[model samples]
Target: MGMAMTSSPQPPPPPRRRRSRLQSATTISAPSANPKPNPKAKVIPLLSDVGRLQSATPTPTPNGNPSPNPKGKVLPLLSDVGSNPSAIDYYSRVASNLAGAGRLGDFLIAAEGLRAASGDAGFAARINWRLLSRGVVAALREHGLPHVLEFLRDADRIGVHATVMLDADASDAVAAACRQLLDERIMAEFVEAIEALARFFVKGIVDPMDVLKIFVRKRDPDMAIRYARIFPHSQLLLCNTMEAFGKRKELKHALKVFGALKDQLGGINMFACRSIIDICSHCGSSVQARIIFEGLLAEKITPNTHVFNSLMNANAHSMSYNFSVYKHMQEIWCPS
Candidate 1:
């Protein structure tokens, strides 16, 4: 011990090195009754950060309200369009523009909106139906019959009438369209299409007789009869239809048409009489042929040689009737 004390007064052990507060806190993990939240831990800002961000944003008005944007445009509502004159004008312009641009679908939509808002007040008059019809007719000429038909149906639904006079080209196109419908066996649509075509006659755009000729050529008996009834004064149509029925051996139809012609024309003409005589000859109806011949005489319609020949031919199988007809023809000719 003496030796140690004499060893440079044995410098007291170096004072224990003191740890800094940071080092002590990091190194120490002591438990507590009320554990406080970690100060150094990351803190996610909830309401405070959101509030700060909102406060930083610039408000349009001093009263914390947003002002209308000068560059933003608002479209008028369809419901309010009825009460708003400007809205009506705006939609009308839109429709006109769309139509002018050849945007048919868009034009239709705009037009429908306007129609619902405007009601029946000059609805049809306000539109250039002629122009619209031209477009549809052009489509029909292009063999777009199905599309045009659907478009017309939709237009009707929206209270838009598409009535247009069909020109020569349009008439031909419509005929072709009808042929297609018939080929497809779409009878209902075919009837409707024909009715639509007939409407052109009402407007004096197409001749009903011409349409009858078309139906005759197409061998559409129903349509021919319909148009014939519509234009009862069409003598040529009636004659042709009767001749067609006779050729097809449709005796019933031929007789029916002949009777109608007689009633409508106030009397049968020489040509019609000849046609009926020929039909009787073909059907071997000697009795009917005799009746028609007598009727022609009673009407003061002089029987021609051709009419007499047809009457004889009708009774050719009956020697007695043939001889009687020949005797009558000789008497009439000799009666000079």
Candidate 2:
């Protein structure tokens, strides 16, 4: 039984794997004092050489991937874009892409970069700013002036005004965007419009007057003056605001605003007169405004077109129409 129980001979050991030449070659080792070059490796031109040779060979895309269409359409690198590379078309596409993606703020910044890059005389002459502005305005219209206002504030938060040209052509571009918002039948809230314009002064990117002029043209001067009251001591600003209230025939509120003016030295006498006249201009059959105008004349304040206009307006609905005032105005102007 013991002899039968003896274990069978042990299985033969597995053969050792032979080291493939590829594995042997790849082993890390210190270099020889004079290393021999590998026959498999090929020498290629450096990166600088690639740029120089791209015209003859295939160039990479704007994204820096190897060109699939080397012989096909070659996109000019942003650096080499000044000449014959469809730079305008390329940027236009880029602009539209960003806007479509809702990166309206970035589109403006990109536009600035493009303009700056092309600022070199070589590229400047070819850029049609108006054409480019079409894209800029489109994005602006889509994203809205509120976004642009916020963008301007964000730029200031990061101290970008010194570097960015929001005060220059960029400023005009943004202002145009604001104008676009006006034509929209669905207007933003009165408070929103005020806050947006106020941001301009917070960073001084746009002239407040520019916006006011727009509202005046649209016959919405009151809306603009409502914005003016947000400024410090804005008597001059409130001057128009009060007058606007009056144009709505809100005489009481208009008088209240006029009284609030801190004209201690009477320096704003001309403004005071004009404001009262304008406020009464539309207030049919109002003697208060005329009384004020006469009192101003008694104080020797020069009566300008505004003064006469207000006088005519106050008398418009009464027996004393503009014609009589017109004759009186001529008498005041023309020497006897």
Top candidate (TM-score): 1
Q: Mind giving the per-residue lDDT tens digits that candidate 2 earns over 2-64?
A: 565678799999999999988888885657899786766744332223245454455677998
Write the residue-wise lDDT of candidate 1 on 186-299 in tens digits. 655655665664434333434555555456556666666666765435577788887877777666677777887788778767788889889877776778888999888787
Worst 10-residue stretch by lDDT in candidate 2? 158-167
Model 2 residue 228 distance off true place after TM-score fit, in angstroms:
9.1
In candidate 1, residue 158 scores what lDDT?
A: 71
Name the top lDDT candidate: 1
Error of 1 at 117 (Å): 2.3
The TM-score, computed over Cα atoms with residue i paired to residue i, of candidate 1 is 0.47
